[model samples]
Target: MTESLRISSIDLAQFSESRDRRPTERIPLTTIIPRAWIGFSQAPWRFVGLTALMLITVTGLSLISKDLQQGEGWWQSALSDVLFVATIPTTLLPIVALLHLADQLLPSIQSTAQNEPVQERQRLRWIFRQTTSLVLLEGVILIGGLNMIRIIGALIARQSGVISTVVLLAGGLVLILWTLSQTLALPLLVHHGHRPLAAMEHSRRLVQNNRLKVLALLGLLIGVNLIGLMGAFIGLLLSIPFSALLLMASCRTQTPWVKDSRRNMLPT
Candidate 1:
């Protein structure tokens, strides 16, 4: 028992030391996308399959909803909004799963290899917590904020279209930036086991520290998805998964994996 405790202490020290040393590390801008390509290649089918399922379910629902399709009356418009909000969870779950899949394929991205392994049960629990928190937080900020802007703009529209337009544009820009900052949250949760808020905070810090890299990532993904859009459904299948992999690769690059040898830590 004493020896076991001593070994545990050494492992804890090594883990802490590695984390402290990693803050200065950064992956080159050019390599992040390329690394994601490699990750995608390793599991192309899995990526495509998950994306396909998400797309089918979401598209099918949208197509079948006559009220949403017509979107004519105020009630229909409101119902359309509800249907759109309903789809957010479906979208989020797949994204979380994609990140998880990427982490599994590229284990080096996760810190668990050096610590206590996250069990299947714990993984599921984390997923539930992450999904619920993100849905609530993002819904309030992105959806609710947009609604607030619309309301405020409408209320003040008699005064000036220019002011209303400015408010809408400014609110949109803030939300876009907020969305970008959250790029790392799921990756952080899957790789490092951070709770939702902690993962979000860490993601924000990472994006702030590496704005250029994150921006480049987003730009590339948007371009890729746009091209995918041109190809119709087939293109999205590849691009969506590829985007998830790229984010995971970026997270891996930010925090390189470390595993200290027990032999090296034994008192000399």
Candidate 2:
């Protein structure tokens, strides 16, 4: 069956109930970081391959953009525009891949300590298409909203510096809050087959009460990546996946929906 039909067949009400039952526990960085290490140990090669793929694709795109920059003609200009548009979607490839990997890894982490049987993996094509759609939808909404804020800020700046500064600051604050609220969106989409908007809304509600904890989690992840940078970037191969696993752990621990889905996947 096609993916659309399969998704349509899922009972969204049950999914909604599962999400609502998500625990309100605070996700400590200490707990999640260790789980991330365990997850990486389970699938080190897969995460490494994903990181390598992202680096290679980005480098290739940078080289292509440099070549395109040298062209000086109407056709070249048009080509550059096309490349710019193409790159937006292409650049999201790694993010989508990481979400797919996280979806696969979360179940193992949950079951491993319990000595429970894990579910068989989903087909790669299904995971790829689902994650790609989720990433694109989220990316468009975020990027479009940020651009609108910037444009409005610029217009206000032309009239009043103080007002424009306030507008920009408010916009930045909104963006950060929006980002924190939607922290569980990808996992919601992967685990429950939720539509993009519904997943985002659920994520917002899930993290609403624990906003500070979410912020700290995000900051900790960023700090870990910065430390990886201190290692001359080679450390990111491990750090990136490490952060991703922590994210999945956070989602799994807080979201009853993910836990329920994993339970259902076990042998009857």
Candidate 3:
């Protein structure tokens, strides 16, 4: 018993040491996002990231229904808005995860045929192709779920006026949960080699202990999400880098599969 206690104490001391040295910062931009995570994690790169943000914004546009009673083309506009909005989550989340996961899984550059420009470019092309397939594979999940959301929303809207506030509230709650689930998955896939859906489970696990921090990150990301709405439509790509920073910072901290990726005092 005494020996066991001593061993436990020693382990605790080492864990404490890791925390001190690890780089877990709240602000993402300050974290040095792994170059591979930001690059290979994506395909057609900027295009997919931009599309993801745009889809999210599309969902946000649903709120415009509040303007329905005030105008001439209100109902018609509302119909279009709802349809487009419903498409958001279905169209983007999985694709975004695709880019994020690929980068995490195959995160490195390779060199073949030294001193040959043609060979280097060919290798680069091959790498991009592989990355693209991964991106597409993950995209299927993203698009499918997003469409499901749209179908449900459409059915609800079909019931027409007097939409139940309770139902709406419940729905909003579910959507928020879904978003949180998506957020958690990225870290697991990137750093831990979890499958895409598996990443979602791990994300939930990571946040089990640090709910407040995860909530805080969610709030911060939401702020960027608002910006993304306007920015994606305006053709601005600022949120990509901002998100990259957040993801890196998140990886360095306590996540579902492991604890304290940063601040290592003892041997991990």
Q: Estimate each model's TM-score.
A: 0.68, 0.70, 0.39
Write one digit per residue (lDDT tens) for candidate 2, span 221-255: 89989988788658888778787777776765433
Q: Write the per-residue lDDT of candidate 1 for residues 1-268, one digit (tens) a residue.
A: 9999999999999999997776543534566566677668778998999999899878866765655658567877777777777676777677777877776665343334343456765775677677678657766778887888889889878899999899889888888888888887777777777877888888888888889887887788799899999999999998888777777667654333444322111111
Mark the regions of model 2 whose C-alpha exceeds 4 Å error after superposition: 1-29, 107-124, 147-165, 254-268
What lDDT score is found at residue 169 in candidate 1?
90
Off by over 4 Å in 3: 1-175, 225-235, 255-268
Prediction 3 TM-score vs. true: 0.39
lDDT of each: 0.74, 0.70, 0.52
What is candidate 1's local distance difference test score?
Answer: 0.74
For candidate 3, give the lDDT. Answer: 0.52
Estimate the overall C-alpha local distance difference test score of candidate 2.
Answer: 0.70
Clashing pairs in 2: none
Range of the 10 consecutive residues with the lowest summed lDDT in candidate 2: 112-121
